[model samples]
Target: MPQIQSELSFNGLSVLYQIAHLLASGKDLELIMSNILEILETSAGMKRGMITILSPNNEELAVDVARGISETDKRKGKYRPGEGITGKVVATGRPVAIPILDAEPTFLDRTGARKGLKHSDLAFLCVPIKSGNVVIGALSTDRVAVQDAVTLEGELRFLEAVSDLIAQVVQTRRRDYDRIHALEKENLELRRSLENKGKPDLMIGNSSSMREVYRQIGQVAPSITTVTIRGETGTGKELVARAIHQKSPCASGPFIAVNCAALPESLLESELFGHEKGSFTGATAKRIGRFEAADNGTLFLDEIGEMSLSAQSRLLRAIQEKEFQRVGGSDSIHVNVRLICATNRDLETDVREGRFREDLYYRINVFTIALPPLRERGADVMLLADYFVKKYSRLHDKNIERISTPAIDMLSAYHWPGNVRELENVIERAVIVSTGNVIEGHDLPPTLQMKDASEQGERNDSFENLVAAYERELIVDALKDTQGNQTEAAKILGTTKRIIQYKITKYNIDFLRFRRGDSTGDDE
Candidate 1:
């Protein structure tokens, strides 16, 4: 068959290729959109352009991108859906091309597509980027013409192709978003399943202090002793509570925890004992209390020292009698929950200060566990650091293989005023931010280091700059040897065109200098 007359203009093909390459290159979306408009105009010879899409709420179609249009003109017709040509295509789910404007119909150009007002002798073409029979968005481009039918037909074809490309892009984006949302929801459920006593991986330490804690947990976790853990914040007190329950025969039961300091007294009480329907304003339904939720399991009260004295008194009675009434309910309910309390404050001192209950302290102090903070854990920091680095790197999908030697030294030397919990948080942050395969000193937070963060940032910047400069020099030397021809240079360096281009951009290598075109701005 003989070749047919081509409608795909050379300029339009170039623009399409550019857009496709940009989408393929995986560049950030904002940059891709910024240049897309100019490229489109160069190809299809459009005077104005607008890209509109259905919002996430699906309540309205809003303009996400527009070019050749002004803000004032947009106000007149810029922010509505199915308004003019753009809206017609979206609503009808079909392309609309205005060849001669019919009888010069009034253009309610809500898009202000090009400039701020309606154009003279304006011709328009709009196409819907439909996905799965539903129009996700519309692409409209206008031109200055006197309603020439043949010219409009060719332009419409150009836009139809653009619309097809756009539809694929939109469908692909929606799929990626749906997949990500599903993964996030799944991870949230998994996190809820894995978490216990507010401590992740709640394992008991083998140290002497923790051994005693374990012994107490073994003794009281099975039996119903209102076990209260005493230690500073971030000391693995909650972990000890979890350990007791795991070791106890009630290992099959739920392990529920509530931070007393985090919630208000009313909410905390309701959380613990639950509330009857109509208990208070916004109590739409009867809610199960934590004790009822953790029935036959262990109930952990973290920051118990901060709980209200009245709450503590009620809590003490529940501990002694193994029963309690819900808030605003007259009926008393019996529960078989084992109580485990943790506190960073001294309850006895609180008792003396007349803030905490003496009776409640005595009841919960039946089994006491005090966790030594991380600074006193001997080589445990190194042990936990290694364990956490590996665990969290996999969790965050990071490339970190291990902590560097200097990082280890810093970890070990740090006083850890906040204890094991703080160490975990710092390591997690480093794992998130660090780009290298290993955790370096600069990766750690400035508060964790001897040097200020700004100083550390500057030092890292300087070092990176030095390295980049050295690499640029190496590339330039290779190119000179190859007589400024990239293919030969790449062969000489045993690389590819892509790699050379990357280095050239990274080092800002000047080919013109090597080409003998000019020595101007050689320093840059």
Candidate 2:
């Protein structure tokens, strides 16, 4: 029988302490679970940590949170009672430890984490997580195999203690989980309803973040409350405002838009509220402002953060009183207009800095809808890109079919600093410049071609090396497209055949694999 190491016992205490702190932190459940797994790995010498929760029907255990596992594998990591090590532990409400995973016939590696590993050196431990004797889940982990059964037993005990802490957290937060599940179901229903009824144009994503945004929009659209749409520039704040307006009761009336930053301070006031014929030198005639023009409808004030302090004061008055006096006019003109404001600027920061009027900030910020940036929208990029491609194809009268795989990769890898609007522009440009039916990698902007060195794990690489890497990629893509035909690839690249041959040799690209119909360029 082997003994538990003194150092491990000390570390185990620290691990338990940290896990308790994390569980009590009241942070997001997924985040807390991830942090706990990270702590176990770094402190307890555990690897491939996973937390599996019982299904609502108690029919199976599903991987709820995991570390050191692929998302695909995590999805595959499911087990029924008496199925595997994890399953047996949860089924019997007992702890299990296999000193050598390879020796256990019941060690089913559902996650595939141990598929090709030398399992002789691996040990598996699983403990049932219970809420007052009723098993709710299982906490499982892998560590280096120990020679002593007693050491494994000690480790199992330690894991059981950890599982106990986890159970407490699960039991306490059951209400939170239930509430989150309810909200998720509600959001799904709302999304389906929108899909059936036709979603608003420019609101293109179905990501969880975007679903929350849609839910908020739906919650506020029926009312005439002031809405402040906050997001980075090019994130389609105006589109959200329009969606709100279209869904509002005042949909039939005029929907007027104004860019507060586009107009000068001298003209901005006159722009929002009408001016008399002799109001100023530039006021040649009595022109109605956006507020009056948008009467009984929605008025979208874009870049509201850029409005001057004077304009904000007048804006606040109009919002509060539902009336305002135009420039050089004393009569109080009232109109039933619903106001929607959008801004990329940090209004809170501006308020603190005295750059914006605090009273106006509170007035328009009655209901705030935050738009997620394009980079955070995940696979929505592909959806948007496809939409833009078809839109531009029709407008430009091009017969563009689809974007190539390499082009798609470039688009996905690039961090869209300018958000959806930038993606729209990129797709339109790609469609315009694309001569063939398919948009290829070369059709993308030069910025997308050369990736950041740090992102490619070549941070120390020189500028020339980065360019060379992009050049090699282009050459390889061209070769693959032409079926390793050097002459044809040269024609596509607008280069001589000799230069193409030289580049192929210089870059060590396997042109023959392409000829053999193997798109996987292993030689390179």
C-alpha RMSD by candidate, in order: 28.0, 29.3
| Candidate 2 lDDT for residue 284 | 69
Whole-model lDDT, model 2: 0.84
TM-score per prediction, in order, is 0.48, 0.50
Q: Which residue pairs in candidate 1 collide?
A: 68-114, 77-110, 78-110, 82-87
For model 1, residues 1-524, the per-residue Cα lDDT tens digits are 11222664456666667877766776655455546666777766775677677644343566656776566654454334556666667778877877654434544555434444445566777788877688888777767655456756666777777766667666665566566765675456336756633443446355444544555566676676677787888887766776677777776667777899999987988988998888999887677798887777788899988889788878887887888998889999899988888898877788998998887777777766666677655577877887778878988998788899889878876778888889889999999999989999889988766954445566547668656645665677676655466666777888987798788877777654455244232222
Model 1 global lDDT (CA atoms, 0 to 1): 0.71
True lDDT of residue 146, candidate 1: 57
Candidate 1 lDDT trough over 10 residues, lowest sum: 515-524
For 418-501, candidate 2 gives per-residue lDDT tens digits of: 999899999999999999999999999998899776577655765676578678767776876677788888889999988988
CA shift at 96, candidate 2, in angstroms? 99
Decoy 1 TM-score against native: 0.48
